[model samples]
Every structure is written in C-alpha cells, then in structure tokens.
Target: MHVVATAGHVDHGKSTLVRALTGMEPDRWDEEHRRGLTIDLGFAWTELPSAGTLAFVDVPGHHRFVPNMLAGVGPVPAVLFVVAADEGWMPQSAEHLDAAHALGVWHGLLAITRSDLADPAPAAAEALAEINETTLGDVAAIPVSAPTGSGLDDLVTALDDLAGRLPQPDVDAPVRLWVDRSFTIRGSGTVVTGTLPAGRLRVGDELEIPSLGRTAGVRALQCLGRPVTEAGAVARVAVNLRGVPADALHRGDAVLTPQRFRTSDVLDARLDRTGDDPLPQHLMLHIGSAAVTARVRPLGSDTVRLTLSGALPLRVGDRGLLREPGRHRVLGGTTVLDVAPPALTRRGAAAERARILSTLDGEPDEHSELRRRGIVRKDELKRMGVPVTSRPVAAGWVVDEKLWAELRSRLPDVVARWRQANPLETGPPVDVVRQQLDLPERSLVHALVSPPLAIRAGRVVRDDTAQVDHLPAPVAKAVDELRARLAAEPLVAPDATQLAELGLGRRELAAADRAGVLVRIGDGVVLLPESIDEAVRTLRTLSGPFTVSDARQAWGTTRRVAIPLLQYLDRHEITERLPDDRRQLR
Candidate 1:
C-alpha cells in the first residue's frame, strides 16, 4: 500500500482533487463542507493501475492549520503537491513545500488544479520551477481540473508512477504509531488512527505510550475501514487498544513497541539550516505527528542541542523540523545524532561533544557501535534494535572484540603479578582483577581469567600456582607434635598458654588451619580436624539429650576444652543446643 499526503495552498482544490480521484468525499467534519475548507485531516484511498493501492491523507492547506497539516504529512512518505492554476503559487504553497523539504520528503507529484479556469501550461511551468529549487527537484507535474474532470486520468497515472518508484517500507523496524486521531468506541473501547510508514501492527500485540509510561494491548486492527488481523507499513491503520482510556490519550500521543525506543527531552543533532542566519534560541520542533517548543543550543557550525519542552520517543538517525514559533517559517532540519545525550557541565564540553558526534555521523556498524559505547549489555542492544552480528564475549555482555582480545592477552601477566605481590592471599579479589584490567563488568574479568586462570574462593587464581604441601619447617614440626598429642586425647584442645609453648601463635595457627592440619575451636584454642568428628561419634552413644557435664564426662575432657568443643559442634550443626544448656545429636 502507498500512503501519500496532500500539500499546497488553502482552497487550492486539494480536497476536491482527492474526492475526484477516490470518488469519495475527503472532508469528514460538517464545518469543513459548510465553510468550504478542510479543518481537520481527511482520509481517502483508491486503486491505481501501477501502484496496486494508494491512500491519501488530505491535509488542511491553511497557514493557521500548519500543525495539523504537519501531522498528516510527517509520517507519509510521498506528497501530492496541489497548486491552483489561477492561483499559481500562494504563501501556504511555499510553506508546505518548506515543510516537505524540512521533513526530508523526497518523493511527490505536483498537481496544477483548477486548470480549466486558466492556462494549465503557465501554472504547471511555474510550480515546476519552484519545486526544482527544493529537495523535491523537478518531479512530474500534471494539470488537472477536479470539477470539470479534465486531465484527471493523467494525474492518476503520474501518482501511480510516483508510488511505483517509492522505496519499500522496512517491515522489520520497530513500531511507533503517532496517533492523529483518538476516540473511544461505545462498546469496542479506544481506537487510534495513524499512518504507519514502517513496521507491522497485529492484534493482541502489546504497545506502550512512553510519555505516559503506560502499556496497552492491541484489541483489534483495521486498514482502509476494513477489519484486519494485521497490517504492514505504508498504510493507514486504526488500532483498538485494550485497557487504555480515551481521555488518557491525545492527538500527538504515540503508541509504540515498549523498550525499543528511548524517550528524551534533550537531543544532540546535526542541523541543516535553510540559511546561514543564526537560529533563534526558541523554536518549534515537529517530529512525526507531534510538535513541541524547544530551546536550541548551538554546538558547532552545523551541530545543535535541542532541549524539548516534553519528551519525544526518538532514536538516532530520526529527522525533525525546527520552525520559528508563530512565524510559519521553517528554520532548519535536524538529524538526531544522540538520544539520551550526555550532560555538558564544563567549558569546552560542547566542543568535545561535537567531536564525539562527528564520529557518529552515519549509521553505526557493530564494531563501531561497541567501540562508541565501550560496553553494552546484550539485552540492551536488543531493546535498542541494534543488530549484534558478532558473538558476545560473555553472557549478557557485549564488548568490542578487539578491546576484549587486548584485555584477555594481559590477564595472565596481571594475575601472576598480583599473586607475586600478595602471596599470602588465596588469589586476587574479583574486584581487584576488574580494576587491574580496567573492565566495567565483573563478568568480563571472569570470562578472560577462566581456562588459563580459575576463580578460587571468590578470587581469581592461576591453575598452576604451587599448592602448599607443607608449612615452614618450624611450623610443620609444631603442627606434627600437636597432631600427635591430639591423637592420644581426641577430645582435648590446647589452650592459649599451651599453644604458645608449642610455638603455635595466632599467625602459625591460622596457617595450620588453612593447611587443614588443625581446627581452631575458639580464641587461642586448636584441635585436630578429627576431634570434632570423634566428639560427635561419642555423644551418639548417650540415650537422651546430653548436658555439657555429660558430654565432658563422655569425652573425658575438662570444661575448658569441652565447653568450646561443644560450642563448635553446635556451630557446625553436628549437635543442637537446648535452652537448658543441654546438647543432642542433630
């Protein structure tokens, strides 16, 4: 389907031409027909010989209704430029042409209407000259008289040829339906009408209003006044939305695919001004079917920062128009460079940002995108509609492959050096490894350190690091003597004084504990690792819940060693402690 919007001066027979072409009235409101002017947007569709089906968004041509005119044309890809033969080019004609140029509308057909009232040749020549000066640039012009029905066939043929030449809309793009009309049906609920130039809308699909932060389900879909299960791009569609009230919506509100777009009030963009004259600080921004007041901050010769009065769901590479508010003059065009732009807080920041934006001029590829963002999550990339052509370095994390390779190459050396600097530690902490590698995500560090190095006890360590078979000679001798003594009396634990006599200080005991040679039961107390097991085995022999005294007598140990030992068994859940200070097997 081909959707085209009409653009020209007021009362230039745009609606009449549409009615002639479609054999249906374009004006919907009674006020429009009574006043002989189009007050709101009118819709009409017709079958063309070469174009299959074509739809017309008959927009108001008056200067006072430019905003309404923009809403109709912003999403439509092609235009049916109307000019009255007697009127030639009027003020609104130039303004509409400016709007088309500002919005980057390139495909169009020029119709010199009311040709029966004047010489069509002269009017057609004048319109063609004006169009050649703008981006439309020498498009096909036809002379037609809607009332007399003269030259109407030629106009349809021209439209058909123009539509055939238009590029196909990308159906895979994200859906963003900028509603021009929204109203509630008595029994069916809320319905919204908009021109969908790209993407597909299907019944039961979920869509969101980003500005309102509300989501709704598509209850039904309609195209060309017929109910449809689904509709694709370049067609006028009406969607019945479930769970959304009519009052919560307005003309400029958009129904979009949630999480696919970012809403921002500030945008960094490249501006193509109509002239070299400096733009005013304040201007009206027209994007899609919405227009809002904005403050412009010049970044460089052709770069600008627009601070919008309200958030718009926009993405990088989207285009919009900037106009002098209330003046009916288009100041320039904007191509979005960055949505969610960085805040400028210091001097020369704008210049630095401009430099960054210069690098982001065109559509970015995968490698460049990764390099620009430094690090991005896979889910974030998917939500932003960015294609991931390469495999991710880690789960849920995407890094520049070149950067990852460089970082991975340095990991072994980094881990080895860290081990050398802190030999007492099990390994370098994960945070320390991340810092040394200058990586933003801990997952990246884990990915790079694995295989060659392994994570041990929450720290990254080399697999080849020497394992301690024995402690220093003096400590080993002390540990052996203590093990022998504990073997003879498994329940007995050395006190602080006895531990010092065996040359087992706090540091020595801690070393023995790590080596699994001894277990530290309490402050300044050490026991063989088997002693706790032996105590549990002995306690099981008792019939009922045993008291501390009963456990001491059974283990044949004094209260000093017995008390801490019983506490250790309770801590390990080998025995349960009762409120009455009794113990039992767990």
Candidate 2:
C-alpha cells in the first residue's frame, strides 16, 4: 500500500479530483462541505490499476489553514500536486509547493484540474518546472477535468507509476507513528491515526509517548478502516490504545517503539535552503505531524543549532521543514546531524563547534560519531542511528579507537601513582580506577589493563613485581622475621606486644597477609600458612572429639589463640562442634 498527499492552491479542485478518484468524500467535517473548502485534513483511499491500495491525505490550499495543511503533508511521502488550467501557479500554489519541497517530498505526479475551463498545457508545464527544481526531479503531468472526466484513465496510470517509483518502506525498522488525529470512542478508549512510513505495528505491542513520558498497550489496529491484528509501513493506520487519555495527546505527539528513540529538544541540523534568502533567527519546525516554534543558531553557512519548544523523538538523517511563523511559506529544509551535541560554554565555543560540524554530513558515520562522543553505549548509538559493527571493548560499551589508545597509554602511570601513595597495597581497586577516569563500566576499566599492568585479586598491579615488593622495605623485613619465628614453633602465635616490637603495625600485618606471609585469626594472634596446615593434620589423628583445652595443650598454644582457631575451623567445615563443647575434624 502507498499514501500520497494532495497539494495545490485554494479552489484548484484538489478535493474534487480526490472525490472523483475514490467515490468517497475526503472531508470529514460538515463545516468543510458547507463552505465548499477543506478546513482540516481529509482522508480517502481506493484500489488502483497497479498500485495495490493508495490513500490520499487531502490538505487545505487556503493560506489561513497552512498549519493544518503542513500537518497533513509533513508525514506523507508522495504528493498529487494540483493546478487549475484557468489559474496558473497562484500565490498559495507557490507556498504549497515551497512547503512540500521543504519537507522533502520526492515522489509525486502533477494533475492539471479544470481542463475544460482553460488550456491545460501551460499549467502542466509551469508546475512541473517548479517541482523539478527540488528533490522531485521529473514527473508525469496529467490534465483532467474532474467534472467531465476527460483524462481520468491517464491520471490513474500516472498515479500507479508514482507509487511504483516510491522506495519500499522498511518493515523491520523501529516504529515511530506520529499522532495526527486522536479522539475517544464511546466503547473503546482513545484512538490515534497516523501515516506509518516505516516499521510494523502489532496488537498488544507496548509503545511509548516519549514527550509525555507515558506507555500504552496497543489494543487493536486498523488499516484503511479494516480491523487487523497487525499492520506494516507505507499505509495509514489507526491505533486503539489501552491506557491513555485522548485529551493528553495532540497533533505533534508521536507513539514510538520504547527505548528505540531519544526525545530531545536541542539538536544540530544541516539546513538546505528552498530559495536564495537568508534563513531567519526564528521559525516554525514541521516534522512528522508536529509543528513547534524553533530558535535557530547558525553554526556554519549550511548548519544550524535549533532549540525546540517541545521535545521530539529525532534521529540522524530525519528530514523536516523550517517555516516563517507568520508568512505562509517555508524557509528551508533540514537534515538532522546530531541529537546529543555538546554544550557551548565558552565564548568561542560556537565557532569551534562549527568547524567540527563542517566535517560531518547528515549520514551517520561511525568513525565521526565516535570521534565526537569519545565513548557511548551500543544501545544509545543505535538510537542515534549509528551502525556499530566493531566488537565492543566492554559489555555493551564502545570506545573511540584513538580514545582507547589514550586510555591504554594512561593506565600504567595511573597504577604507578596509586601504588606509590598506597605503599602497603598492590594498586588501586578496579572500581576506584573507574571513578578516577570517569568511565561508565567496570568492564571498561578491565579492558584498559595490558601486559605491564594486571589485575591481581581485584586490584591493579605490575605483573612482573613480586607481592612483597609492593610493601615498604621495613615492613617486608618485619614480615620475614615473624615468618621465621612461626617456622621454628609451628603453632606459636604472636601477641600485639611482640608485633609492635617488630614494627609490624595493622597495615603492615594486612600487607603481609595479602603477600601470603601470615594468616591472621583472633585479636593479636598471627600464624604462618604452613602452621595452619600442620595443625589440621594433627587434629585428624585424634580418635575422639577433642576439647579446646586438649588441642591447646597438644599444640602448646594459649587458650586465646586456640579458641578462635577452633571456631575458624568449624566455620570453614574442617571441624564439627559437639553440643558438649568439643570438636571433631571433618
């Protein structure tokens, strides 16, 4: 299915041509038919020769309803540019053309209406020349009087050709349905209608209204007024929502795939002029079905920074139009360049930013994207419309190539400085490195480790350095003396007085424990690793459950060390304690 919008001046027979083509009234409101003019948007559809089902979004041609007309054509792709044979290219005709061309409507066919009133050849030739100057390069112009139906058959053929020329919609793309019309039904809750240019929508799909920070379940779907479980792109659709108020939604709101788009009020765009005039500082922004006031800051000759009045779900390469608020005309067309641009804080920042923006086109280039952002999550890069094909340095984290290299170069020095200040420990913890470097993920910190720097027991260290080398010389000597004394007497534990005499303070003892020189147990008690091994072996040889007193006497250690050691053995499952206060080796 395909959708086309009718564009022309007032009383140019746009609705008449649509009514003649579809046997259906394009106008929905009674006010439109009473005044014999289209006020708001109108919709009608019919099956064509080669085009399966083509829908028409008939817009008002009068300058007063220009905003309503823009809301209709802003989302539609192709157009049926209408011209009256008697009146050649009037004021509203030129404004309508400018609006359509600014919104980047490329596929279209011109219809010369009222052919019976005047010569059709002149009107057809002039409208085609104006259209070809924009993206709609060349198209067939068909002259037909809707009343007399002179060339209706030829116009149908041209419509089919235009439909075939339109690029196929991507069914797998993320859904972004701009709500053009939203109203409540008596039995069914709220319903919204919009043109689905790309992506698929299914019943019960959870969708988001980003600007409002709301989520709704799709209760039902309709395409061309037929109820269906699902609908695809390039067709008009109406959605029944489960959990929202009809009054909360408006023309500019969009129903989007949750987490798939970022709603931003500030964006950088590349502007292309529709004419030779300089773009104004303030304009109206028309995108999808929404129009909002925009304040523009010129970044370069063809680039701009727009601060929108409302947030919209935007991505790179999306096209929109900039129009003067008062004039019934379009100022220029815009292609989004960046949705997450950096802030300008310095006096010369805007100029420097323009120089950077000059290097970027509207297309999403991964290298240029990463160069500007330094690092970003894979999910956000996808939302920004950048394709990330390279392997992530960490889980769901991508770092720029040059930035990764710089991080690698800085790691060794960072570890060295931390170790120097903390002489008793190997290095700073991984989480500490993450905070110091302002990295988002711990896996990213691990990815920065290389040969010289290694993660040892959760702290970074030199791979070639021995564990004792991380301590000061005096602390190392103290640890060696304590180990020698424990080696002579297997179960003799040191008291705090003995430790202080050896100058092994709390930090020194902890450093020695980490280095595997000693194992700390109860308060003021320290033993060698081999001594614990020997004690475990001796306990198993006892036939019966032994009391703590019996073990203390056998090892000739004091009661203070023996009790805590027995409890530690029980905690580690090396021994089971009896109800009578005795212990047995497991």
Q: Which stretches of candidate 1 lie over 4 Å from their true place?
A: 409-424, 432-440, 467-494, 498-586
For residue 12, model 1's alpha carbon misses the true position, in angstroms, by 5.1
Error of 1 at 152 (Å): 1.1
For residues 1-586, what per-residue lDDT tens digits would candidate 1 score against the true structure? Answer: 9999998959739999999999988899988988898888999999999788999999999888889998898989999999999988888898899889888888998998898899878878888888888778879888988888999999888998999999999998889999999899999899999999889999999998886688999999999999999999978999999988767787778999877877889988888777898788999999999999989999888889999999988877777889885677888778887775779999999999888877776453566668877778765655544667777778778888777888878887887787677544445788898999887778888788767578865677656634333356677788889888888887777777888899988878876776566888888778887787787888889999989889889999898888888888889888898899787888
Please tell me which predicted candidate would have the highest TM-score against the true structure: 2
TM-score of 2: 0.93
Q: How well does each candidate superpose onto the true structure, as a TM-score?
A: 0.84, 0.93
